[model samples]
Target: MNALYHCISKYHSIPSGAWDALCKTLTKVEIPRNSFLVKEGMVCNNLYFLEKGCLRGYYNLDGKEVTYWFGFEDNFVTSFYSFISRKPSVENIQALEDSALWSISFEALNQLFDAHKDLERLVRIINEQYYIRLEERFMAMQFKTARERYEQLIENSPHILHRISLGQTASYLGISQETLSRIRSQG
Candidate 1:
């Protein structure tokens, strides 16, 4: 919880009353390994602050799961488009390990936004950060070779290789296990 508070404070500081109100709306949730926090075609009604463990967000492409991103402790997780638009999500968010989270419903968060302008600014900044990362990923996918992508991933997020399976890492890097193996062996 303190980590969550610190994360929020780093974005923007809200009034104590608004913080209390926001805290009151948060609910604790526990998800076991390999379980889903959200699934395709479901409306994501809550935003989660991960307290422990790891999660992955992915889309199913012709029966294959293509991982887009991962979230670990002290980070907020949500199906952003679905949460904001109240539409069904095309992606799934799954727990990689036994995870604990603090969740706030869409309605509760919106209410907080209405009541606290600072909270809204904080969310906007967070969304901007999300978009920046998304663009970086898009550029990497567009311009970089598979080997370069793998190298960039290893350089930027080496912890991912340690925390997830090689198969999952390969999926995230937009490569197959064999290709990843070949590249790793070349190093």
Candidate 2:
């Protein structure tokens, strides 16, 4: 939980008492590699703080998995729409490695928001960051060529290549596995 505390403090400093209260609500969970934290058509009832390892959010489109985002250690992970709207999610969140996570249920989180206003501000800031990243990915897919996208991924997240399969990376870049192989060969 130290990692979670440190990450949260970077965004907003919660009073010690509020922090304790928040800690009490957290449930530690372990997800094995290739296991799902949330699956399509399920309501995401908990928001997770990844303590260790990796996870990816993807959509199953006509039987193909299209990964859009990856979450690393010290990051928050959730199906934002389903978590907030109380609706079933259209995407899935799967652990890419054996992972340790701390989760807080939506009900407990709301109670904390009502009690600790600062926590609410912290969540708002986190949401804004997520939106900014989403916009950047959207723009890149709209304007960048496959090679350019692969280069940008190498520049921004080279470690991802070591952590995930090349096929998954290719999916995230919206390119064919063969195209990614060709790009790698050119290097």
Identify the leading candidate in terms of TM-score.
Answer: 2
lDDT of 2 by residue, 124-167 (tens): 99889889999999999999999999999999999999999989
Question: Global lDDT for candidate 1?
Answer: 0.92
lDDT of 1 by residue, 1-187 (tens): 7878989898888789888888899999999999999999999999999999999999999989999899998888999989999999989999999999999999989998998888889889988988999999999988999999999989998889889988888898888999999999999
TM-score between model 2 and native? 0.97
What local distance difference test score does each model get?
0.92, 0.95
How many clashing residue pairs are found in candidate 2? 0
Q: How far is 51's C-alpha from truth in model 2 (Å)?
A: 0.6
As a whole number from 0 to 100, the lDDT of residue 35 in candidate 2 is: 100
Clashing residue pair totals per candidate (backbone < 3 A): 0, 0
Off by over 4 Å in 1: none
